[model samples]
Each structure stands twice: as structure tokens, then as C-alpha cells.
Target: MNNQFKDWKSNLDRFFGHDFWGDFEGMMKPSIPYINMYQYDNEVLCYVSIPGMNHPKDIEVFVDHATLTLKGKIEINHRGGHQIKAEIADGTFERTIDLPFPVRSDKIDATYKNGLLIVQLHRYISDHTRQNPVQIRHLEDE
Candidate 1:
């Protein structure tokens, strides 16, 4: 009976252990600096939440045809005391967002105020009907 009880306790520990839950918790959480985006007829706007940053210039913003990337670091001043609880995220982070349409790279603007980064982008209009003619070659010409 003692051996059976020990086996049951071990099985319970294996099922509800700290190691298993720790990994699961890490996997469930998303990355830091959560962002919200809005789309307009000719523009796209994004609002990014990143607090505790020293300066606005610390963040880097990159814009491609249809993607926007943000890179930055968040640092917390501990004041030389041992940390008891840490809910705010620190360290370097990069997040890429997909835009609804291709944006004009030269017409992008960004501003940081009150722990929020606002980005404004203009949509790029391309001529879809314009096509480049491809030259076809015969196999014997190789």
C-alpha cells in the first residue's frame, strides 16, 4: 500500500509540476511592445506601446513596401534594490507589422509621446496594368 501511494504522489507531481507549467506559461505569453494599427483609404497609422524608454531616438523604425519594423530597448532603473516582482518587460525587442497595402517609403512619419509611438504612412499606388515584356528563348539557342 505504501508503494502504491508513493507511485500516485509521483504521478501527480509529474502532471502538475513547476517545470511543465513554467514552459507552458512562457509559450503562452506574447512578445513585448504590443501594437495597434488602423487603416485608412490612403494612409496607415500605428500606435505602439513602449514605456520606460530614456529617449525617443533609442527606437528604430524601418518601412518597406508593405511591412513596418520597430526595434528598441526598454530599461528599468532598479535603484540598487533586489527585484521582487518584474511585470514590465526590458531588453531589446523588434516587431514587424504587415500593412494592408504597400506604403510610400519616402512619406512615412513617426512620433513618440507619453509612452506611445505613433507612425503614419501613406499608401503607395502602383500601376498594375503596366507589365514588363519577358523575352523567350528557344532551347536550341543555348
Candidate 2:
């Protein structure tokens, strides 16, 4: 009986552990910006569409080898003109993504062009995980 109970517990843990549901939710949620991620020979590139954000000071990027986080706020200045349609999203938003592979936290770059934010992360060559936290860097930090 003891062995059978242990086996059942292990099976349950295997089926419902870690972040399986959270990962599914992240992919299904529409509130987060859609990301296009691709892996290259030595780096990974992620692109996100964020229109109307004209300044670098409003964005923050962080990576922890296996995960990437983006948080920022979009502020739109509206003139006194009344009676207009507004469809753009404003206010603070955050999105977390699970990276496909371990990335070197020390060698991450981000750039904003037109209405897209491009992030490049170099693949970690060694098995060592970074001891420090990934810095939250804005576009101007480069």
C-alpha cells in the first residue's frame, strides 16, 4: 500500500507541477503583446509591437536565462479636442515569456525602432547560471 501511494503521488506531481498551466495561460492571454521569437546560431531575437511609445524611458527589460520580462507604461497626451475615437492601449502593462534556452544575462541588447521593440539575447555557452539579476535596462541604456 505504501509503494502504491508513493507512485500515485509521484504521478500526480508529474502531471501538475511547475508552470505548465501558467505557460498555457501566458500564450492564450490577449492582454500581453504578441512576441515573435527566433533562435539563431548564437543569439535569440524577440520582437514586440508597441506603437505610440516614443521614448525609451517608459520601458524596462529583464531576463533570467530561462525567462524574460517586459514592463512599461504608455502615456498618450490628448489635446482639448473632444469627441474622437481612441483605440490604442495606454497605462502600465507587463508581460513574461519563457525563453527556449539559457541566455547570457551579461550580453543582452534592446533597441526601439519605428513602433517595434527588438531584443537580442546571446546564448550562454557554459552551464553556469548567472549569479546576479538581469538588469532592467531601457533603450537608452545601450
lDDT of each: 0.86, 0.80
- What TM-score would every model get versus the actual structure? 0.70, 0.60
State model 2's lDDT: 0.80
Best by TM-score: 1
Q: Write the per-residue lDDT of candidate 2 for residues 36-87, one digit (tens) a residue.
A: 9998977899998777687876788989978989998766777688847856
Model 2 TM-score relative to the real fold = 0.60
Expressed as tens digits, the lDDT of each residue in 8-117 for candidate 1 is: 76676698874554576679767877889999989999999899887898999999899999999877766787889978877889989899998998898899898999
| Worst-scoring 10-residue span by lDDT in model 1 | 17-26
Model 1 local distance difference test score: 0.86
Q: Which candidate comes out best when scored by lDDT?
A: 1
Please identify model 1 stretches exceeding 4 Å from their true place. 1-26, 129-142
